[model samples]
Target: MKFLWTLFILMALMHTSSAQQTQKPVLHGKNWMAITGKPLAATAGAMIFQKGGNAVDAACAMLAATCTMWDMLSWGGETQALIYNPKTKKVIAINALGIAPTGATVAFFKNKGYNFPPEYGPLAAVTPGTPGGLCYMLANYGTLSLEQVLAPALQLAAGYPIEAQTANSIERNKDQIKQWPYSKKVFLTHPGENREAPDAGEIFVQKNLLQTLTKMVETERAAMKAGKSRKEAIMAAYDRFYKGDIAREFVRGCQEQGGLITMEDLARWKPLEEAPLKVAYKGIDVYKLQQWTQGPAMLQALNILENFDLKSMGYNSARYIHTIYQAMNLAFADRDFYYGDPYFKPQEPIKGLLSKEYAKQRASIIQFDQNNPRIGPGDPYPFEGKANPYTALLKKRGYEMDTTKRNFAPVHDIRNTSSLIEYQQRLWLGTTSVEAADKEGWVVSITPSGGWVPACIAGNTGVGMSQRMQSFVLDSTLSPFNVVQPGKRPRVTLTPSLALKDGKPFLSFAVQGGDTQDQNLLQFFLNIVEFGMNVQQATEAANINSNQLWLSLGGTKNDDRKPRPGQLLLNNNTPETVRNELKKMGYTLSFGDRTSGPINAIYFDWKHGSFWGGSSNYGEDYGIGW
Candidate 1:
């Protein structure tokens, strides 16, 4: 009877613990705080600030520890960072994007019978940038050496309890993982026979990754003994992967498998640091990564919306949400058309795209009565002094060019039957973000991606290369962002955000959804700036649909692969009447779920000498200030 009672108690405890994972996170501190997708990593970052490390050091440590989460980020992945230095009053964009190999030409894939690189495998892979990025942060901006910054990640890689989400990722990809012996050895319980992912709450240990990191640590130590400076010693560790053994193995893997990467590519590849693409919005200056990623999509959306009274549109009302989605679609269309690797197209198109006049033209295209059948790219070329042809088209429809609008009274019946099939909500999360602000007025935000678990492992180096090459478009008809070429980093999707007010740091934020990164962050910002929600309220708010559209090749049942128009994902909180009204506008609407934007945000209220932090469903995220 005593044994039975003990078992009953254990069961009760297990149930209680499982319930906590679903609860919203609540954490705030004053004096150096770190918040990330994982709890341990957040704490690890906080620990660094307490140890007298700067925001860059805390963020570097946090990013390193974040590599343990294979579902979100990997040790060998692509990474981008935005650092704000108060003294210099400047923001730096780190383009730690993995580059296509010297041999990754369009002909190579055309000969392989693929329209593009296969979504999986070494051919889709690029040289990872995560390690080199972390080391770059250490050598340039950080106060701690790589030996010190790498400690938390090394500790976690040695042994840490696996969360349920991570275990599920391992199990779902177990079949693909087992085919690669090195991957089978690292992520599963045992090779082949016990190949399933470990049960959740299991103590997961990755000795292989630990060994790889320890070798770098050893290199750092050796350099220190050889009389290297702190930064030089840290870079010695960094060189272990870029110019050393790991780079050789990575190149060898591609060579053996007939993939394109080479050691020379790795050796010459350095993370690019440049000034941010700054855009002025509502008196606040917003900064984002350059043209390489989709960061500009957010800026373009804000610029277009600035023409309208977004505050007047009741927050989250059907009309308000529709306006936002319409603006998003317009921005995405521009992104597909104009954005690309600035290195290839040295003349970035931002000068024309972000201009207030350009935005006025785009905003004028939004029709509120009925959803646009499809919104594609617009010509942002110099709009002659004469009104744009779009303005003329609206005037022909008896609409004015100014904000005092008329005629949104339903041109076509939305309830009219159009053969449209609904899509299931997506569950793809292949990247992670981290941010930190020290009491000393330094801020950092980074989005690290590329090294997903079911990816290339670089010939036993345990370095997972990115399939980010999939983001490239083979044809340049839409934009030069297309047209793959050797020695070019494909246009990427890792967008991080930083905001400044009155020349002072005001916000540091990021979200993790490939094409949806800009979509979600744009909405979250509106939720705070326009809707007046606090940090936590803004985070837990629902995202509009991410897979709500596809390009419309031909609008019929036969054209499902192309863009589907007027789809919205809403939950119960959205009134039934709103759904009916949207449907009446001819939209293909779905319910029961919304997009997952497991986001975290930190606010730098320097004026008040405090910070506000909030995140969606929590495992290890917090916002603290000191």
Candidate 2:
């Protein structure tokens, strides 16, 4: 990021302006609220709420606003969400993850003499699902129309300040954007010369994106005058992107650039409405997305951790960290081997993968006195004979183990590395999340990602493909997650969490990063639930990552051999005594200025009829409530 150094100088100046800095997170009143990666986006959602929209509407608006600003998170990408419908008194998981093209078979890339598509380009993209997913959320549960919720984003695109976050991302990805002519035209130009990043507070206009959004509005208007209902009018825009001319435009762009997406793939696409993968931890019901993401891994880790007395061990203690790491190792091993699209038979049964009995069986192996550094996937499958051998066979074919590799740079401000999108962030670490709740008890938690690195901008449309295809592997080995098939969604890492206490909504939270997302969430949960940290304290607390051997979704091939459970990155803020204790237990460790996972959260206090909200100071996180 070229402007990073400049931004740092400016940031230092801001810090000096205040006599003292308080680490405590911000507070909010008991009313509707929205929290996200940027103050501007949060304000956009808050505006929707002020205008009489509900949580669903506010969250979707926030998501769109974030997408317009952060190319690293989404322009076109996957948006996975968890919505709590107060009317139904239940949580719903919206699997708005994109899918592989009908033509994206393993042999297609194999013949090209590559292990997979290059990290970022047209070939790496999947059909984009962000718009479609937002449309669905609005049409189904939201009271506001698409035009209403997206109004802020459209206006922002017309002319908005280039905040530090967006400026940094564009600077970091400038070279790559230059490779695609259309991408270059839209993101990298300044009338006559090449585009330079707009300074933090300077205005930046996205005319191309503005035009694209305008077209959607125009298409919607045409549908309405033609007698289509409001829902139908929204669908008209969705259809244009997924099945009409816009779909063909993407197909055309892909074909011209040696990519495989097609009209059939886009037309056939529709975000799925599924039950959340739910689990109970210390009398609270926690809901995360299904296996299509690593959301369930949090559930698995929580299940294993339940067998221990965490409070007795004390938070951030060696015992606590080790137990959590071991549990994460066991859970992530299953994630690599078993988590995938069940629709394609990812080998493991959904019930068995999340069963408490299975968790107990896996948890029984942990030794609190020592570290279990590198255990592979345990037998989550109940029926030995019935278990398929696909994943096992593929391992024999030389894919090595799929783990997130760390090409970590020297310790620096994490905000500097914020340019990374979801997968690339597994190394540098990043993502985008939004959580909003209304006075009516309706709430939504979502993680939106892709359309940067592993993704390339589509031709002329100002939209890009989500690099979710990088999450999928191409082989007959039946790697639950990597295989590609027509309409098969790649297993993603976007997970949002919701917790209910006493059968009532108590908390909504999410984080940005690849595998670190769950880890971040886990730390926050314990920070509040066990250590009695307030929402702000939990949000600001330093955390660690179990990232030794793991490879991220969209991860490229790494020649280096890594240890199982990998090396741990300890946040110095957690105390050196605890770090030394973990090393004594045989846990390898490294250090960083900040934790890998950056989180935003909201806690509902039914006893007081109020809410507390907190956002990360790490980078873009901002919180607003009333």
Candidate 3:
């Protein structure tokens, strides 16, 4: 009996160790790999790569195709990307985020009785960015012509079988779609019918969008015929979009719909190529965009977590979850109050915010036994050799005066069950991610979003306007650094990431949930780095999301922007013991089968000289490798 019991125990251990499985197979490629939010969009990237284009070219093609597919975004959306340039041996940031149009001011919105900008329609738009962003990236870094890169998108505009997710979303939001003339004209093919929106898998076409793309391609061809360089030809197409016929129509439709966008806003707005911020964890260097995005918060969390023995705590253990939650809340508190447009007045204290010493200071105050619901922004100015300028403002707003002690939570936390559905829709609002890599060592990770379903079309252009302006706050008390102003870009939740190991490309990854992006990303990184999981395993790994920060989207009034303290989203597979432990620590828990991400990623295997692609099973995210 004793010998049989020992054999049974050994067999059970072996079974448990080998039980790890994924819903989708890990994609292996020798030459190239492309991943995105939709299968057809990934095919567009694969098409570009097959045409001998590099990673940037393939990524641009995927971006254009996804925009046409309306994968929670469109051409008028904003784009933020992290590109690894082989020649430069450095990661570069693409700041294609649109800025507030002229006449957009705090007083302008305050007079309208809005706490934040409206959530939809033309009034919510900023200047379009993705079109210029795609053009600039292609012209500078890509080896393909604009015509070739835009071919898939043009075809998509002409006609393609619409997917169920998008078709259903349009049908559900039909009433809002009816409000916009151009939207109703395009989306509701069978107007006044029982089911006006296109049925799933039905052929959906956008003639106006097809015409707009045709015009740009013609301009590019004309520029080339006139003896222009490749870059110049692409720029000509860009000029046609921003300063020519397309711009005029966009502004006209905007103004007719009582929007603030003007010709100057279109002409003056251009995509910027900037340096990305980086932080070293262990030996790997992680890169993210600047303060204009919520990316640095992840860096802050990493810095704080470095002080603890996370691996020793065990994966998804009670202590590990508690530690991660505390660290995220601490970082997010600072993000809520400090993150904003870096180009504007009163520059963000990024130097101090990302300081290792500041991270240590913030980490030292965490209560290991219970959740701290009163976590608020900390004073980072002192670390940067400056006095805390927001001291009075912090105290006046009931924040902790003692920088080292626990702080009061944000002023708003109204819980109303009636509006919970609306709030959740905005909080977990979806977008799409693009990841591409090729044999040349070039890699691209992009998180582009803004113009989603029910978006107001800009005139006969068939281009949806961006609704990114809602990210801005009207009251300085809500965010001193992110107040609404003309020409200032709103601090957005979109973030893309790149990591380098031993001075070579290691991982390129991104995801599409609003505030939940960084939270999932943090865990994904740790899963690989600490737990020794492969790229695919890490992507599908469970993650916890903290809702302790102010709502960044979907708020019409002040109460709607309130943070839900102690709220945490856990994976449904979490052990009951872990759940019980978290409950005792004051966390209000919610569970979902797919709690983490529809993350898309590519891992560069330097030793094997190949790529490993990962597309999580949470959504329709797909990938192709060859």
Candidate 4:
């Protein structure tokens, strides 16, 4: 009788836990679905869809709207996307991430006594990429004209009611905004008033930005008048932004503010469309961008986790958490060292890093009893039939052996450490995601970032300069692949994902968080495939985050950006038993009510021939489906 009672209670507890995953209802649609960081931005995508646009056109509109709204990014920001084309039956990557301008070499920064590039202002700027990226995507895959696609963003540039999140951000960072003359003129509406930033719900206007966008549209219209093809017309607009008067003003503004961008830098840079990398996990194939971004870290993690029976361990179980955390750290360690620009360098051993044998070799070092604070990058060259040239450097840097005495500071100094962690969280917190899908089998997943608020506006263009230069490292000892160089792209945290099953689109997903992007994405993917959760549930479901890898953003000093291994973030509602077990395994735990980050995704419901959209309740992420 006692055994029966205990079994009943266990079942009841499991049911209750499962019920919590449905905090938000699953969004269903038959024709199309558009989801992004803000409701207004999603509405922009929907407007395009309602006007007979496909997923690509809608996605470009959403990207423009988000950039105009300063949804954690701006016009000068970079964009990274993965698009699943139904006609071609292939997933293509958009490498619109900005490159370092001339004079942005490691020596240039090292001469300033800096560990990494500066975090903000014109000095931290990279050449803008989003404008050309949107134009390229629209011209190649979209059916609409450039002017038609940019209507919503042009309206936004004219004026819109600013949200409190953005208004307050400007107010909080007003001191820094004042450092740049153009930014001061555009952001500080009240000038000498105590509250210079626009108040929440106030109509915010950018005349200069509106004019700049108008110039692009006008160029497109003029090109059409000249009997140019649609693609040629769009390319004309791209030229105006890069090599024309807009570029001249942007360069003038950038250089006027102690920036390094030259006219040649803007004229030379162009977005690339390349084949994406993929790895098969179970029966499903997951695709990510090249090694330039951290997208492959998730692929590596999935390959490693494939060796274990994760479903058998149950969701959020202490053992499951430890396994996921370990696999993520292992993958990220490789990312910190090996992932960078493919166009530069001796090249990354990507073939070996994504190999099943390499995954198994990395997985073999995992110890189930306690966290491995000294987890480091693995040697992948052997699997690709090449010698490991960095073996000596790895050993010299103390990453070849386990020498960590403690992963957490002593209890007496916990408060000071907490303050630094809070700052680190802010640094790792930016970017917004876009996910859109249509009944025609077109899927788009984009993680666009850089040029966040308090941004330094480059000249009279009213476009914020990219702060992406900070993502580059000055010392080759840290990441030989990611060392700063003129015209080279930095390894970034923005990653978008796509998955296919049985030769069809299965899922398109992305999230807004720095280093935590892939960590949340990996668990979200598992929540659906392994745990049988609906799209919405998978997005909102509680997941753990591991801070055992190097910081990818915001630190002026090397020590400030060092990894804090064994530090784990768990949902506050985690069972006491699970918490105790994790504690026993040497995890220094932190709790949050929401830890999944803001994940936006679209799942193609093949059986029903519909679309399922998921927008996490963690932030302002929203979706519109019809």
Best by lDDT: 4
Give the residue spans of candidate 3 off by over 4 A.
1-19, 399-429
Q: Model 3 misses residue 611 by how many Å?
A: 0.7
lDDT (Cα, tens digit) per residue for candidate 1, span 310-395? 88877667787788888888887777656778888545566777778888899998898987765777766574333233333323
lDDT of 2 by residue, 90-113 (tens): 999998888888777778877876
> What TM-score quantifies how close candidate 3 is to the native fold?
0.95
TM-score of model number 1: 0.86
Candidate 3 lDDT over 444-540, as tens digits, reads: 9999998898899999998999999999999888788998888999999999999999999999999988888999999999998999888888888
Better of 2 and 3 by TM-score: 3
Question: Which stretches in model 1 have alpha-carbon errors above 4 Å?
Answer: 1-26, 192-195, 383-428, 546-562, 592-596, 618-626
Encode model 4's per-residue lDDT on 524-607: one tens digit a residue.
999999999889999998988877777787766776567777888888899999999998998888777787788999998889
| Local distance difference test values of all predictions, in order | 0.72, 0.75, 0.89, 0.90
Q: After superposition, how far is residue 422 of candidate 4 from its true place, in Å?
A: 6.8
All-Cα superposition RMSD per candidate: 10.0, 7.4, 3.5, 2.9
- Choose 1 or 2, whichever is better by lDDT: 2
